[model samples]
Target: MQVTSHFYAQLTIAIIKGVASCLRLFHVLGLIILCSSLSLPLHAIEQSSNTQIKQVHLHDNQGKSINIGQLHVQADGQFTFELRDEVFSDHFLSMKEMKYIEGPELWCHIAYPYPLNRDFNADKAWLSHDLLFMYKKSNQFGAMMWQGVYYKFTKEDGRLIGYANGVDLSEIASAPEQIHTPFYDESYMEPHNAQERWLPTLTID
Candidate 1:
């Protein structure tokens, strides 16, 4: 039987996912519940007293920090990502193409397939039963998704990893110059290392 490209791609992606699963990636089975607006969903587990949050520095390869944000996770399994300021929002990459497991608590999101890997931060999400996961997607540099949500999240295995929907990238290319500055609004500008990077991926655990 001759198979169509779409089917073939899906099969390949599913296989990759299977391998990833064996390697300890957790898959949440159910329909996705997207947030109404582009904001992190935290109300899902407000009653969980064990929920904890931490503030940390997001950095570039040269060790120069570019963004500031917080990370939130709950005992009920929720992840949220938020940005501290909008000054970083000005250089937002392709956000529509880069939707994540949860909404952005940060200004924008940067992943392997997008512009600055220096875009956003992580937060506990209400999606996947508020499972702890993060993601990045794009049409440029082709589409690439990475996730690590371990349901059996024990202290040894950790709680989250990034993810992808197992699809091909479309209408994506290296961003134009105007959209390619290290994430900054007029007030702040922090440069990265000399190396040119189109493949930007960062994860905060």
Candidate 2:
């Protein structure tokens, strides 16, 4: 009888340990699931593609070729462009506000409210930079890149070809209220000025 009781006690202890181990495993799995849920929003941002870098070149009014930077063009006609810091130091860009952007590489986008659309109004487009939020903090009306820019798209046997024309840098200096306005605000949307001749032509590869 004593041996029987001892065996039963040992079996009960083993069962208790198994249940405790299962509880610990469940707790760890729950924590992992919670962490994965928390990280989803950050990864949910719109990405042009899984990962693709396309080179871009700029042709000035004088017909000088300039290496702009890497670009990722989405099927929806949006563009993610990264520019080199040396491009800002060049004589082509005369804006003093360029100094305010706090980064060695400048990333700009033609997205959302101003995505490049061929079926829609394809002529007027805007290129806003990643640093626009920083300027917004100071309650200053500024854009890191061009606002009222001209873009034209062509279809070669159903393949879409994009072209960017004259961009006015002065649009960076706008009314202070423009700072408060949401990027989706269409009130400031307008055609590019004819006289503005910074990048006369842009070729996207």
Candidate 3:
């Protein structure tokens, strides 16, 4: 009887340990499932945040429409704006010239008679999109590169308005005598006289 009781006691202890091990395994699996479910939403939100704006209808304040060939937005908030109009093609300055023009009063010495033959490279410009504003680095001469220019446009009511350019020139001595707004309404007259005209402004519909 003594031996039988000892055997029964050992069997009970082994059975209790087995049940406890099973419970621990079930608890671990439940934790893994819960963690996996929680991570799915985070992954989805990340993907949504990186969404791109494929196309936006752009118009000017004068009710004129502008043709933007393509706009590619990146995850880091930088975008590329491509012009569809051939008239505006090859009318811009090189990125190297833009660096020198951004400084104070130095750009006025550059002559507009000789136009640069470089193509408008959208990859060179770094465009930033804020809540309702698009800011970009530009060249001072609409048809030439003499100074660095900055442009700020407000996107409201489905129209883009030219808000400001560069620092407030009211206090600067070297500022342009007349603020020559870039992107004016200019028709392409001739290949050599391209600088004599202005193009229409751009707005998003």
Candidate 4:
């Protein structure tokens, strides 16, 4: 009878231990869930692709090639184009010259009022670097980056501030790239072969 009681007691103790272990496990899992829920970043999903970088180059002064803006998109859906040139110059937008941007709903803020009086029109900027000219289109009143550089002007009344930039090709990569695709852009222009039609911008480098 004593042996039987001892066995029963041991079995009860084992069961109690197992139950406590299970409860502790559940408690730990609950804490993890709560912390994760609180610590989630608002832009975690939005910025997942923000680290991408794209190739940008512009013709510079001395008739040389330059890489100006390191263009990339942001989590808040804006373009942050980093330029190598500090001061505005006569040529070399991709190498610190102006950058052209085209993105969704980005043309409004930079556009002036249709009647485009001087007060309504934004100041014009001529980017000497890369020979890119930025002028507010009076009729459309949106900023244009002529001479191949990307630039923007602002009219407080306008809805869009600038052309929204596109995604960076390098952002789609996983590891450092060893072999790079040549920057030959002739194909980007050949489609406009029809007479008088504007050709797509091509890069010689």
> Tens-digit lDDT track for model 3 on 1-205?
9999999999999999999999999999999999999999999988867745544333333454444445555576555444444323232333423212121122211222212222122311122111111112343333232221222445577544432233322223244344333222112211211122122233333
* Comparing 2 and 4 on lDDT, the stronger one: 2
Q: How far off is residue 39 in model 2, in Å?
A: 11
Q: In model 1, what lDDT does residue 30 have?
A: 21
Best by lDDT: 2
For model 2, how does the per-residue alpha-carbon lDDT over 75-103 read when each residue is reduced to its tens digit?
A: 65555667656654322123433322222
Please report how far candidate 1 places residue 168 from its true position, in Å. 7.3
Q: Per-residue CA lDDT of candidate 4, range 120-180, in tens? A: 1123221111122232222433233331212232334522122211212222224434222
> How many steric overlaps are in each model, in order?
23, 0, 14, 24
lDDT of 1 by residue, 1-205 (tens): 3578889999999999889886663233221224333223454445555766644333333544443456565665454545465423332233444333222222123432333322122222222112222223333342232222211111223533222111112312344355444321222323222243211223345
Q: What is the overall TM-score of model 3 with all chains considered together?
A: 0.30
Task: Mark the regions of model 1 whose C-alpha exceeds 4 Å error after superposition.
Answer: 1-49, 91-194, 198-205
lDDT of each: 0.35, 0.45, 0.38, 0.34
The candidates, ranked best first by lDDT, are 2, 3, 1, 4
> Model 4 segments beyond 4 Å from truth?
1-8, 27-55, 61-64, 74-77, 83-205
Candidate 2 versus truth, CA RMSD in Å, comes to 10.2
